[model samples]
Target chain A: MSYEDEINQDILNSKKLPEKLEISVLRYFWQSNPLIGKKTDSIPRFLRKIDVLSNFSENELRILAKYLHLRKFQPGEVIFKQGELGVGFYLLYNGYADIIVENTEGTDEVKPSSKHILTLEKSDYFGELALLQEISIRNASAVSRQGCELLGLFKPDLEELINHYPVIAAKLLQSISLIVANRLFSLTREVQELKYKLSSYEKDQDASN
Target chain B: MPQISINTKRERFKLIFFISTLLLAFIGLAAMPRVSIPLLLGYVIFLIVYPAVPTLEKLGINRVGSIWIVFSALIFFSIYPFVKVVPTVTAEIENVQYFLPKIEKYVTKKYEELRIEVREKTSFEIGDKYFFQALDWIRKTSTNILLNIPKILASLLEWIFFIPLIIFFLLKDGKKFKRGILKLTPNSIFERFYFLSHQFNKKLGDYIFAKFVEASIVGITITSGLLILNVRFALLFGLIAAITNIIPYVGPVIGFIPGLLFSLAEYGPGTTLGAVIMLFVVANAIDIAIVFPILVSKVVDLHPLTVVVSVILGSQWLGMVGMIISIPFAAALKLIAQEVYKEIYQE
Candidate 1:
């Protein structure tokens, strides 16, 4: 047989029905195997739902997941205290966490009052500033509302990622920057609206006078 | 409220359990010197070479491939030296015994001459009691060390087999190991503990790397200079210089002493002695001037007094290894202290 004809013959032989069926069946079995495959697949699956990390590909997310630390917190447990140095950015992997801001002003130093800022649910992330800042201080404390699991990525992990996987690190940084930028944009808009309201209120008082 | 209390109690129990587990593991490791020593040695080597793996990975090789490359390169370089240098170093160490008696005799003769001069000058007898005792101590220690060479080499041969295995596994699975420990850390102290350990490890790695380079420079300079000067036992003296140079302020002087005495004994207090003295001075001057400022000081950042005190304490506790590790340990302590100070006073 000629070289091209020989190659065609080999391709035809390999494409026989039994070989294709066997390969597909083996792949299906491998994917469906709960003990070996599905356990490690959960983290990447969880990460896939995160809006900020949406930029990461499946492989990238898998690599990123290896760097994360899964921490379990008891109910009412303090994740971090206000004004404490923080080096970890954490994602709420499961359950809820409360962000609490303590009232720093006032003489009630011994029994300071705290205000609830927000309750973060699963897929929510906080502490991005910790990863970016040179000296990150917790402005508000994070406490587990009714027990939770957190996936934490610390400064050291980020540094390792940057060293070993610069592409993933850059994408992560970009996502964090996007989050910060969105928050800043909204904050500035709120400030502008408040300013306009204040000016109108002043005009109304002047007109009344 | 009752539930909260129960949760806190559980947390406290977990924290204590975690701490005790760590302590137990440390005690276990410390109890076995044969394993722990090589493990420690491998850890140090791992720290020194770990950065290269990441750098190689950045150049586009896969992690395992990079690890293998770095590992093979390390093995090749180390084995080349081991094969070539061991016999020469052993011979030199053996020859050093004969040279030590000559140095001792020279010292004794000088002391005698000094004693007579003092007696003549002041019409008072000079006691040779303490002087003779010191000479005796030196002679005994030198002989003991000469006898222990074989034992040291035997342990070294074991370490040769053990350390690379430890290093290879460490290089491969170090991240997984760190993660495993982090998983055990209590939630309350996790961030602080991780940060502290990370900083300490980085400081230690940097300090060791700096010290290694500094010692190599000093050792090579002295050895090559002595060889050029036709000094006997050049390699042995060079090795002594390198090893002693790991200690802080007193190290350079201690390293120079044997060479000084040897030259004085062999060549008298003349040109060769001057040349040897000059060689030590220049080598140390290079260290203090160029290497210390450039490499070591930046990594350690400890005050001279702190270095000296730590070295003293370390030598008291763990002898030579303690002295070698003291500066970095002190630096880590300073970091922890600073963190505590910030916590208490700043906020």
Candidate 2:
């Protein structure tokens, strides 16, 4: 028999309920769901680094795993185009992804080439800010460097989850607060350096004159 | 292929009508005088059983074992509290009953003096009819509630047996129940309803968890304050406040009644009056200034007036149960309304 026929036969044989089912039948039905991919569990390590699911309990994590959709990307396939509506977060399970930004080569010295601003490795996750905060298009495009597996958790699910689990919502808020605070600190440092550089440039100009 | 098909509007409207009809039937049953006791008992039983799923899951026990563990835990949680407090409180209640007539006499005398004063000052007539009418109304209401005692007892006994059994089956076959529900749906509306239900479940779970935490905080604070004041039945009174804290605007009023009665019984009217006033102010201050703003922020997006109006309307329609569920029900309605508006009217 062909593989499809064999699989169909297997399903028929398995149709009879087992003498004693161990898990919640719901878990069994979910486990059999075709939407959940073989490597869905692999994505959790990467997603754990994202603030959203970091502190979720095992049951909560499992619920999240079921909710997330698995999407695969071949090399050079854009995970998300830069200027599209962002709906979900992507977790890189097994391949490299590059975050590309379109900008002149230098801030002052303009050039034609756009930059690969950042490259992310395995266990890296992105697209969260857009999903979490309902921002417009992503700031950069993430292209898979090779064949990759990713789990996409949509925005609406997250909001619903947060509403149901206020603790999780509270934690998400806390995480956002931390991210904003970190950005503020970095911006402050960058501003101070820029001020110093501008003052030095003014001194050089005065000396030249 | 999408594992769960996204059904079209035709399929969804059918399911929506079906679910809405079922819910309306439940509400009707809940509102009926005869069936209200059983319906409440059944609902509470389901609630007790439902929480067992997680409690068992958390313990890393198998589903059957988890059900047993949860069953045992609930029995302990409920029975233990009553065991510790009920006897003492019952004895106190008996004492209060004996003194009730004397206290009423004193209150009437004081009221008579105030009535004479008011009669002299204003064009007000002091009539026993008004007082007797008020007393008669209270008696009637109390009797109505007491008449349901047998039904309530039957429900309690039924719950004692039925909760565990329902919980076991729920934990065991809940997935099947859900899947069966899903399978019955026409493919057209499956996806949207599935997604919406998922969204609703998550929101509900979070709302309950947050409310539990918030109520606990309020309960503990009130209890501690009452304990410090050496108030009678501090734990019980604290619990009353905490439960009342569930309802917005009206919770503090419910909390204050028991506190006032306890104060009156323990101390005379003059001395206890100060304590009663302080209890209301403090308990309410905590709820308003601290507990509410922190616990349930943005969960119910209705304006203050809207919330007040909804509560009153809900109370009128379904009494206390309506009051308990009104906010969340209103919130769900608001959510569905917004979604429908955006779907139908938005460009």
Candidate 3:
């Protein structure tokens, strides 16, 4: 297997965390948990390492963890499929998931692989477009390339969180803008490559004639 | 380049979309100030019905009874408070007269002292006529406001009496009301409207609940704190703070000014100064550090800058009531625009 494939497998095969630690790990995102006086020390550091919850205050990070449902996906588990009603934004807490976009021609334009598409590891996030717009389905599918730990934020919960915490909205906006910019840059590069390929093909045809 | 043209066209389209949304939002915001009694009643009634639906169902209340119970409760609770508070708050203006002579004397004394100090340092004359003229303008404005109370009260009572009946009818037929409106729309647009309606309801409901909870908590907290501090009029000041706290940023300041003035009046300047400083710090700290951040995180997610800007713009158009409705109204409009743009344009 390729090095990338090995990395994906390692993520999928990673051991589940201790049950006691699991709640704290989840607390890293949902800040509402401590309202009734549950305290955890380790969660904030863990959430800070994750890109999405990094901007949350120590208190807010705890609240965010309360709303998150952490789940494990084994290799090849379909996390979500294209055209599914968008509900939650996801984060790769551990392991790798492959993002696959299906084109109109029934072909998958894979970002990294023809079979599985792009593999993402820890700290990577997706499905943000779902949070912003209603009636819009997921544009792509995320299938676990290896065993993966993922965090999810359902639509209603996110809106509630945003309404309550303006700072979180600011952070999410920054993350979203970064994601959009990255996508635009990649698309520009692809277009440039396509143009280069078309020009070379034209030159080759002239020589052959 | 082909890419440049596509980018430019896309940019132009985005600009158009953004401008149209802003215009729609402004129109919606402007409508809020003029929401009239019936619509305001409808909004409050709609809110109570959602949470009460399950409870009412469990109690074997049908939709009509639920509507009656909700509307009746709203009238008893809301209108009763307004009736109780408006006359009392208006009567409290009579107390303003008791303080006015003291205030004028205080102002004159302060101005005389300042004038003496200024003359000792520099020859800048503040004319006596100019001071009296300014004082006269203040008295005129105050008297006008005082005189307008009865006229305002009459209109308010008329609106209040009609609101509950309107609320009852709306609650009785809300789902039907919604469906009937949608049925008027073209088939192609129904799905979008349906989605938009759901999104609006969800966001608006969440925002209102979060805000109500936050305001209640803040009010109780400040009231308890004031009681502990032995502040006079603790109940009234705390109540005002809690109600105005609904308006974001400016609410606490408005709450503090009256509290500070009373503190100054009761205690000498030094004690008043300390109390004012302490109140300002504690009240603002609790609001910004704890209440607002947590409340906002749960409800609308608008940027703080956006919230402040919206509040200022909203207040400019709608006055006090407009300011109260501004945040959620802005959020609801944004949700609608997002739903529309995505469903209509993208697809």
Candidate 4:
């Protein structure tokens, strides 16, 4: 079995804690990382180990850490499906995920397997498009390539954070915008190059005619 | 990007679906006040316990352990009043009932004397109805409260048992529960939701906490003062003061009269009344001096007229309890208004 398969098995084998302890564990993870809470290391140290959350201050990150829910996903599990409604954002913590776009013309939507567009590793953030739009749909499906631990920020969580600590929310918005702007700029360049190539090709065709 | 709400048809459809789901939930709630009451109580308890979770965690306790600690402390505090003050309040009610006829006679005599004096001076006999209307209202309110005492106790008992447990689960699964509710908001409205909810939470929580502290301080002060004066049912009178003090604008006046009457019953108008007045003055001073500073942010800015109207409406609807809740309710309404209007008309 692959390492991914092994991690998936480990997650399954993980002992279920008592309800009270489980709640504490969930709350602790959601509120603040236990590892970072002990003053053993600064949040930036841990954040640097992950991608995306780079722009936020240690103070802002501390507030964010307190509320972000760390979620687990198994290998072969679909995190979300293409064309499905989306309501939350995900920041990958560990393992890998396949960003897949379904072949809508032929295959079944419910089937696990799809065309993989890219592999997202640790620190890679996805599902942000869902956050930007009022009603969001997954353009590409996200499926775990291995057992993964993820930091999940649902819309409500962001809203609550925004409500209490708007400055931090502003910082988070800026981060997301940076990513979106980069993507938009790159896409604009690609489209410009494609348009130039197409026009040149058309001129050649005209000459042949 | 900030103003970008559900721009696409699909997003709008999602928002519509979510709103419809909310409408259905509201309908379900309206059909069941019994369930809704407990649910609302649970939500309120959760809100109170929510900030305390971090404190407990900071103290090196796990969430469950923290919740256990908070609940235990709450129970310990709550049981003191239940065991000590509740019986006193009940016994005082019986005493007040016994004194009702005598009190009525004394009031009637005074009313007739005032009416006679007004008739002689103005030569247009002002009806005793106008004079005694206030007394009648007070008498009716006290009797109503007395009659409903059992029901109030029953509800309080229910809350004591259920609220702690509800608070426990709420703190445990609060984020998850909130997420479930938030899932209903389409991204378009989520920002608006975020802004309004934050303002609402901060203002309302601060207001409630400040009021609670004010009440406790007032209760203790009045109770202590009355004890020093050797006044009867000092705890009961103090509790009354604290409760009425929660109602804005006219609360202190309402609270003062009962203490005056208690003093009147004990030592006539000479000694105890003077002591009572002095006690109130000192208590008000402390409130203005200390509590105001602590509650500067918590102060629910409302027009005096708004307060009076709300108080009257609240009294009409829910008696004294209604009156107490009405001021805060009006304040909350103001917050909602500010949120909606500000968002709607943003430059």
Candidate 5:
């Protein structure tokens, strides 16, 4: 018999009513009910999709979720401005954000021109340096592209987490450190590639001369 | 772009709404002292006791279980003081009023004797106007406070009911309340506001906790010392010392004055009086040498002038509660000021 048919057949063949049937019924209502039950599990499920947070267990993610502050931003609202002091690391929960850096070398005008660095979608995180630095200045501004939701873990929250859950704090710090290391590695490789290109261009100029 | 300007306008509106809501809440709290007083007291107590919940949780108890344990212990300890100390303190305060006349008589007699001696030696007549006026002022204020005791207790009774309930809820859902407030905070100022508030709260908590321990040590030392010496109104005097110790710099002297006057009038210039003097000196010495340095000074980190100014400002604004809260309030203001300074100049 097919799996669904066999389960149905077993239920039909059972002579005595199943024990704890009332509890099973109540639990079904509790879990499947639209209003209350699923909300608590949603944050942990969201955290599970984050690449950096993948190492955190289901329980750890739940604990981490308690420390997060969910913030909503309207379209075109500034998340943070460049050169401003920051103390939060945030993950985009929904919608999109654009990272923009001002071109300081541009001619003085009424407003300094800002260049778009990148757009971040769901599950993307930024401002990890703020969590670790003593005095962190935002290197780039992030503005919501079309209204977004963010889950922010701040310095104060991190401090409390460290005090209450050292293991989880350590895991979080490790993840943040991994992100920083990866970014630094790629940046160094890009600089090396540029250096090689510069030398090759110089040699070609010398040959042409 | 028009979009950016519209967003800016909307953000500004949100910020204004957030600020006005805060102001309205403040006004509401001020309008009703009955609820606010207990809430303020509960918040202070919560700040002091809330750390224990985490400590209990670290021992493997669940969060709710840990909160229950800490709260029950708080209630258990408070009950004894409520039961035993209240009546004795009330009785002592009542008895103190009757004893004040004897102290006044002794002081005037001493002044008369001193006046006679000074006239005989230097031929300069000393006026008793300022001295008598001062004496009258002290007597009137002491009597006024003693008379107000019943009224104070009526409110204290209300606090006894409300504070615990408030504290219980705060312990259980304090984070939820905080998150709720955070949700209301405008996004433009969210991170700055959050960091400043958290820092201020931590500073306030540490300062209050330190002051509490310091006051208790002083109170217990003086009370037990007086009891050992067979002094009258030991509890009353100790309680005064403890309450006044919440103020900085001048507090110890203010606390000592009542005991000094009472000891002189009650026991005269003899061994008992000398011992009383010694007790006040030792208790304050311990506070200055040990407790102040170890507990208080670190938490406040304000200049002495700043402390004095804030205390004056605080007393002018809200009397005793203002004085008690002044240092932390000043510290918070300084933190905000520093942040603003950095933004304006350092950046």
Candidate 6:
């Protein structure tokens, strides 16, 4: 058989490339017809699943993806701690994260200071306030619940993105702001419902007495 | 056990192949300077003008138009000042060289006398050996640079003739090339490759841009300041200050020496003192107050000691260009190390 045919046969036999054919074949494939206008196809499959990036088009994402960084963490790793200055935001690509708020009401020693307030699975993002505010002090802590991968977007990169791709930058900032607003509105509604229940409970007690 | 062994073997294979590929490419480039030098120069120019391309696209300009506009503006600004300044700089450089002997003599005499006086009275001997050693180093560096000028000029001319086309192609195809590389990355470390390269590009590119801005500010301010003071060789001093300002710790010292020497020899200690005070104020104040705060703040979070060491090693190994690039390379390495370490140890 010819070399090409032999290579094909080898590929078919084990579904694993022969050692010599492997390196050469991959090289040949990689070097083949590199071109212009390569789109955001390289936006990692993991990042594409994130809610914040979900709304972005492939082209738009390609631009934003250029500014992001990737990081990995093990189970029990503290991503950020409460009261610490938040420098950037993270999109959890895989695994689980726990958003923890520490109770500051008790004495410094002897009291439970930390509790898991929220569980953030894949696509959930946090620390976004760092993007919008001049100073961002973390209200809660984030700890990896498992071996996790994350895509990080920082303040400096945002600034650069604004300068370099203003339209994309504007749309992204708008999306982030909308997410924050929705969260706030939900929290406000919950507070109002709790207040109404408390008042009704007081009236009930008065009537019974 | 079998799976782990297989994964390890595959990784080792990938490592060998990747390293070999890099080595081959580097060797090929070194082996063929004529083709490679122009490509290298073009890549550099492409990097410098790349950010503007995206901005122009956002502003609704086409690729060709964007490239033209950016390059035209750069060439114009660069060439105009270069034409006007070159003549004056060359003349002043001649004058500086003529006065070098006197400057050396004065410095040596003063240094020796001070050393003797200290040894005689204080029972402690001051060493002048290091001073001469440094002077020798400087002399060797300048002479080597001067010697290489003609060869450099020839290569630059070749690059200038070929660079525009190379840059055009790079701008057109760079994204595709990056995507191709990214697409080839395995899922296991795809994120690692993607983020590390982005960080490298951002930090290194920003650092370079900041240096250019710092140099320009230093140059223009010195030129205007000296002209106002009616000092001789104002343009030359300004140019010198600008070039050396890019060098970190030793740069300001190098920039100040010639101006002080000239002023002391020609005008007297009164003017020399003024010159000294001016250099101190301008170099420190402008660098600290304006340049760092505005153009360069936190671009590369390298310690000062890292910078000094990088410069020394770079100069020793690769001379002028190496010295300029050393800091950025060091910063890039630091960034990769931090990320990789976090990945490894955090587990």
Top of the candidates by TM-score: 1
Write candidate 6's Cα lDDT for A1-209 as tens digits.
76678778877786676555566766676668565224335455555666655677777887687767656665665666676556677887778878888776777676955666778887888888978888687898777775677777767668768877787788789878878998899999999999999999999999999
**Selected candidate, larger TM-score, 1 vs 5:** 1
Error of 4 at B44 (Å): 4.1
Q: Which stretches of candidate 2 lie over 4 Å from their true place?
A: A1-209, B1-68, B86-96, B120-125, B139-154, B233-236, B261-266, B269-272
DockQ score of the complex predicted as candidate 4: 0.04
lDDT of each: 0.88, 0.64, 0.67, 0.73, 0.90, 0.73
Ranking by TM-score: 1, 5, 4, 6, 2, 3
Better of 1 and 5 by DockQ: 5
The model with the greater TM-score, 3 or 6, is: 6
The complex in candidate 6 yields a DockQ of 0.07
lDDT of 5 at B13: 90
| Residue B133, candidate 1: alpha-carbon lDDT | 89
Q: lDDT score of model 2? A: 0.64
TM-score of candidate 4 versus the correct structure, residues matched by position: 0.62
- Calculate DockQ per candidate and list them: 0.29, 0.03, 0.02, 0.04, 0.33, 0.07
Q: Model 3: residues >4 Å from true position, as ranges?
A: A1-209, B1-38, B78-87, B123-136, B221-236, B337-347
Candidate 4 C-alpha lDDT tens digits along A1-209: 95446556766899453344345655656678545455323434556665456777777787787666565555555566676557668888789877877656564755544576888898888888777787787798777775676676767667666756767788888888888888899999999999999999999999999
**For residues B1-347, could you state the per-residue lDDT of candidate 5 as single tens digits?**
21222277888898999999988998898677678768888999999999998788888899999999999999999999999999998888889888989999999999999999999999999998999899989888988898888899999998898999999999999989899999989999999999999999999999989999999999999999999999999998999999999999988999999999999999999999999999999999999999999999888889999999999998986678778877887998899899889878964
Answer with 3 or 4, whichever has the higher TM-score: 4
Using DockQ as the yardstick, the better of models 2 and 6 is: 6
What number of clashing residue pairs does each candidate have, in the order they appear? 0, 8, 30, 3, 0, 0
The best candidate by lDDT is 5
The native-contact fractions of the candidates, in order shown, are 0.55, 0.00, 0.00, 0.02, 0.55, 0.07
- The positional error of residue B95 in candidate 3, measured at the CA in angstroms, is 1.7
Positional deviation of B211 in candidate 6, in angstroms? 1.8
Which runs of model 4 end up more than 4 angstroms from their true locations?
Answer: A1-49, A52-66, A69-209, B1-7, B20-46, B115-141, B296-299, B302-322, B327-332
